[model samples]
Target: MTELTPREIVRELDRYIIGQDDAKRAVAVALRNRYRRAQLPEDIREEVTPKNILMIGPTGVGKTEIARRLAKLVDAPFIKVEATKFTEVGYVGRDVESIVRDLVEAAIRLVKEQHGRQVRGRARAQAEDRLVELLSGATKKRKSANPIDILLGNRPKEPELSPEDRDKLVVQQDDVRTRLRAGQMEHEIVEIEVEEVRPMSEIPGMDVNMNDMLSGIIPKKTKLRKVEVREARKILEAEEEDNLIDMDQVYTEAIDRAEQHGIVFLDEIDKVAGRGGGSGPDVSREGVQRDILPIVEGSTVNTKYGPVKTDHMLFIAAGAFHVAKVTDLIPELQGRFPVRVDLKPLSVEDYKRILTQPENALIRQYELLLGVDGVSLDFTDAALSAIAECAWQDNETGENIGARRLHTLLEQILMDIAFNAGGGDAPEVTVTVDKEYVEKMLGADLHRKDVRKYIL
Candidate 1:
């Protein structure tokens, strides 16, 4: 983060996303500001807060994509939640505070994964030793005593092994270890003891802390099971990894990461922006917005792991605003999001770039998919232009879904080729998609007056 400037962040985003320059620039600056805040003195840093962003645009127009790509670029903990999924505090639906909890959970998983990688070598070595012991039958056997002797509080002891037998056992164990390291005993079956944890009872939409407490009180049970060496190695490796990790440190770092680098993308926020009228769903809409205000502004949320502070966490909210404008939101809630960016509707040229320009372009994806069946797909420039024009015409005539229309258009254009690629009646080994082929595949849909009735 300290190494990447705002310009570099935007440059990185441009590879996958086609347009929405304003949105990209706004997010880049916000991310860079986080780095800047970290360098400030403690007092000044504590005073600074994130200038949350609000993106106003139609659906499928790169609003969500910009936020998602930005989070991935920085490797931050991210969660996308629809505003409609939450309701007022007294309502039966999920509360807005759950958003912070979800973000913290993501942070814990991210931090734990990093720790796991750091300890993988040690964990593997320990697991290999355990596996060798299991294969060599070094585990102590329990003796079965008579019932009368057990009742009298007396038990027989096992005799010590002779030196010669002990030396032979050591040699056999060393041979097994050598074979195990060379991957020669992976298929050998062995019996191992595994601990089983009881499942805790859960109530719908209940706080997670109570479940944790209930689970902690239950004693773990162990059982022996026979498994192949390869499968057992995986199980033991995971167990060793868990044993090596310190939960206290994981929780502390996870909380710090959530406070500093977490990003919560609130989508469909316009759905919660209401007219603030009398009783009904509209009333709850405004209530939901009010509920989200403090979290975005800065507040502490209690999660199962620990209490997480949202002081410096970045919040990027997006909404189409087709039915309600941004002004409809409560004043206090709207004030939290100071930066605003309106993404432009995608154009035909944008569609063309989406199909051919990006690193994971739709055309390249299809080519790779078809190539798996020994079919070669080639698309001409004229064919790309025709396809983009058709997608543009469809969006203009019906629902404007932006670049997503290409998925439908391309799938329809190559349906027969994909279904029969490995069949007896497949097309030529090398298939070329030309302008005429595009017209033949999609011309009828483009020319139809009732575009909604024409399925792709």
Candidate 2:
């Protein structure tokens, strides 16, 4: 984070998103500000707050992708919640405060995984030893004398093995350990006791979990089940890892991480900001905005982990605003998100770049998927131009869903090929997608046109 400046951040974003430089720059600066704030003195740091961003854009225009990728880049705790999913304070069981709780949970998961990786070596060794014992039957139960055995002239007794016998058992255990380490016993079935964690009862629209409240009160139930050696290793390793990390430390660090670095992307905020008669659902929408204001304006939300402050956590709210204008939101909520960026609709050229330029390009993804079945795909440049033109024409003529139209058109073109190829019995073949192939496959399915003017 310290190494990535706003300029470098925008450069990284350009690799995935073709256009929308304004939205990208806005997020980059906001992210850099968080890092800058961290470097300030205690008093000054407390005074500094994130300049929350409000994104006004249409759907499928990289609004969610920009925020999601930014969080992944920095490994920040991030969650996306639709503003409409929440309601006014009193109408439903869910309130705006649950966002904080969910963010805290995400932080805990992220931190715990990091700690798990650190302790995996020790945990793997421990789990391996336990698996070896189970495989070799070296671990035993105490013997008990039985009346039936006495009546049959054979009495059960606890055996005190001689040194030679114990040495032989150790050798057998070492052999088992060697084989287990080599994965030679992966498919071998072993009976192991696994504890069952019952899910906490849930209420509709409620975030309260009873499992946290019953931490030490109830005993966990363990049941023995037969499983392969591979599955047993994972279960044992997870249990060992849980024992290695400190819960109190995780809670403290997670709460701090959530308060400082959390990103709550409030998507579809226009739903709450939609114009209404102010008598029906619009009233509840107004109430929802008022409720979200305090949190955005900095408030401490109590969570199961601990109380988390939203003062420094950055927010990026996005809405298509097709019907409702940004002014429809209550002034308090609108003021909380001061930085606003309006993303432009994607052009035909932008659609072409989206298909082939990103690190995870849609075309490459399809090629890889088909490659699994020995089907090689080659997409010609003309075919790309044709596809891009079709996507743009569809968007212009019908609902402009931005770049999402590409996905739908591509699916329509590839449906037959995908279903016919992946049987594992077919020979390896190459399917070239050219202009004529795209036209023939999508003839009349696309907007009927005598001349395709946008084709490059």
Number of the predicted model whose TM-score against the real structure is largest? 2
* Candidate 1: regions farther than 4 A off: 140-166, 195-200, 209-211, 275-281, 423-428, 451-456
Query: Across residues 126-155, which tens digit of lDDT does each residue of candidate 1 receive?
Result: 999898878887655547666567657687
Ten-residue region with minimum lDDT total, candidate 2: 142-151
lDDT score of residue 228 within candidate 1: 97
Cα displacement (Å) at residue 336, model 1: 1.0
Cα lDDT of candidate 1 equals 0.87
Estimate the TM-score for candidate 2: 0.91
The 0-to-1 C-alpha lDDT of every candidate, in the order given, reads 0.87, 0.87
Candidate 1, after superposition: displacement of residue 325 in Å?
Answer: 0.5
Q: What TM-score would you give candidate 1 relative to the actual structure? A: 0.88
